[model samples]
Target: MTKVRNVGGKITETTKGNDNSFAKENITYNSQKKISFTSDKGIKHGKPETLPPPELPSKCKVEFRPSKSWQGEFGFDWCRIGDSQLPVDKPYSDIVGKYGAIYATSPSAVFTIKPELYQRHLAEYEKFVLSAFGTYYVPNLSLMKGEIAVLDAAIEIKENPDSMYYKYDKTVFEVKILEKLSNTKGKHFNDKVLEIKCLKEFSSKQKIELIATKNKIDNKIGQINVLPNNKVKEIDILFIPVEHNGSSGTIKGKEITILTNALKQAYVKGNIVRHKEKIKVGGWWYDLFFTKKDDKGVVSMETSNIRSIHRALDDVFFKEKDNEIYKNHYRVYMLTNSTSLNGMAEDIGKNAKVVVVYNNRNDSTAPHELMHAMGLYHTFDNDGLFTYKFQNTDNIMDYTHQVGKDRFSTNTWQWKILN
Candidate 1:
């Protein structure tokens, strides 16, 4: 049987087969055009991005780069490299040319940004999500791990008239690549290791200059930045367009920030451990199924006496065998345009998967509702009254927002559900 659903400005169609298999298709719309792509597992396309990248660069050179997936194949989820968690429903400002970077969305396919949506994505969106760095995912221009980045005409070799036999010893293409973040695997790639291939080929003039300076006075990229997971991120690499083509012939350009996917943490309240890792999470499989949008959508708990958004979601999250799907990991069912993120839990004896809704507006309620699924409750439900105490101010399950505090801390006693 085939079922169609429309929610959150997107359309999802699911089909179940006689053999008990499932296939889902998602359709999203843009005002000017519609862009679509596929993935092995469904993605939560429009979640708010709260985690930010490191302040410094993670430059790894050819010798130090990892051998597993150098080209960001695995979890390199930065927007520039490819799989950024950019919200799809936002307005894309198209302000650039046709030649933009096309990155791998899957091993078999890559997502290419249409030219109209180029600069808006590369410039504005990149900046909005980043405090520093411009989007530098352009191929050849965007150097990956193990890729040697050099300023073509940005830095011109100048003559050092004071030094004998060192005519054009001034810094050039190599100096920037050695120090600047061509790749940020989080190591300092700039101690100036000679690219083995060309060392012997250096003329006596270059050799004399190299031996004189050694490592004393070369370009400096300062220190490397590491992410929350204790690994240097490639997306944090920064490369300036300073060509030693000539001293006076320098070109003006913006800093191209490399992008990588990393999870962010809320340090004060470590309860949200999911986003604490700097490394991207892969295969922690979960799907976001949407219930049809309604004028009323899902009722707001603040206004409504009682609403069973969870039960509504469980009814349609999947029509086929429910136990088979949500057995291992719980599923998130979004009630698009809903005013509430609250939902009920798996009803007793229903064997249904726990369903959680996304408040298309305020997302603060998600973690709280998930806490319910993890077996938490209001401070107390005694006498049918939701309990409140000064201690409950930090509890995610409490109505702490009423006290003008947006808190996520949970008392140790309430966290026993995880064990």
Candidate 2:
């Protein structure tokens, strides 16, 4: 038979006349004694019914004091065992002293966890220890649910700068997660997209006048809603110079002599002279007449004479009264004699437009005049020309003689205007 009795409010039993039973009954223990115990269920338990959580698992905290010897030096002092120093190879007292010496010599340093921050850290520490021990267990779901609440409270505390301690100590610092991300937020679309427009226009002719203003054209069309897929219809152009009448024909004998002499003088001076004549008289002239029947032709013709060159350009092809005569589309007028129709455009606004090179010689001159007929301008005038350095050569705009032809270079600005 077995007799049962309650010891320390727990049930235990013994068999009648068993030696084990007598040993169990006779075994006396002191209340203050620390001993290991095993229950009948074969479970081993620690001597203490409960234990204070690990004060320091891997990391520890210490109060920091700046050193008087240096402006940015610091020292540490342990305030509480669980709240301050962590358990490491060295005892808490020894570790704290060593850290203090290290802090005193170093510049500003950050102390990781604060005393009030320990609760959250301790929970994290428990997880770390469990993982280190290879124990797999789902954490308390309640803890996961409370994460956001914890973060919110921490943010509020961090924003209140006064809530943090060690206000005067510069060498020691604390960084909180919430404080680091305090001012972060989503960006607005307006902030992301910025609009900027830079526009410029240049021409060799001074003060360009518009036969039809852009506002007038826009107003003519009226306000029409433009749909995403719909596009503006193309229109025909008029009054653009495509071809010229002056490139051919025998001038009066005296005018021919004047043109011949001008050419010879330009050749002797090493300036690019267009004609092979020995003498030249009267001004040179070329007419530009465009032949495109549509409005697109007008815009195309407007681009000629970009650089300073002498020639007369007439837009007879596009401006003709009969639309049937306006199909030629393109023309180039070039004149290279200085005195032949020089500055002709300034004189007869009707018959001839001339670009005169007053006292300049360089191979760039002929090409420069042709470019003018093509609606191109000098490289320097528009702030678009880039040269390694300004040399004492003819200003592509100025009619000055250049010693050599190697002194010329063109950049994209000129190319775009020509095209």
Question: Model 1 over residues 44-96: C-alpha lDDT tens digits?
Answer: 54745444433323111112121221222112111222122221111222211
Which lDDT tens digits does candidate 2 get at residues 1-419? 46665577644566677332133234466566576675577965454433332221211111111111211001111111222111111112211211122232134422222333333222321121211122111111010100111111101111112112211111111212222222222211111111111122112111110011132221110001101111211211121212223322212223223222222211111122223221222223222322223455431122244333322333222243553442431222232323222221222112222333322223344334433543443322222232111222222322333333232222222333332
- TM-score of each candidate structure, all chains considered together: 0.25, 0.19
Best by TM-score: 1
The C-alpha lDDT values of all candidates are 0.28, 0.24
Off by over 4 Å in 1: 1-312, 320-325, 339-353, 383-392
Backbone-clash count (model 2): 50
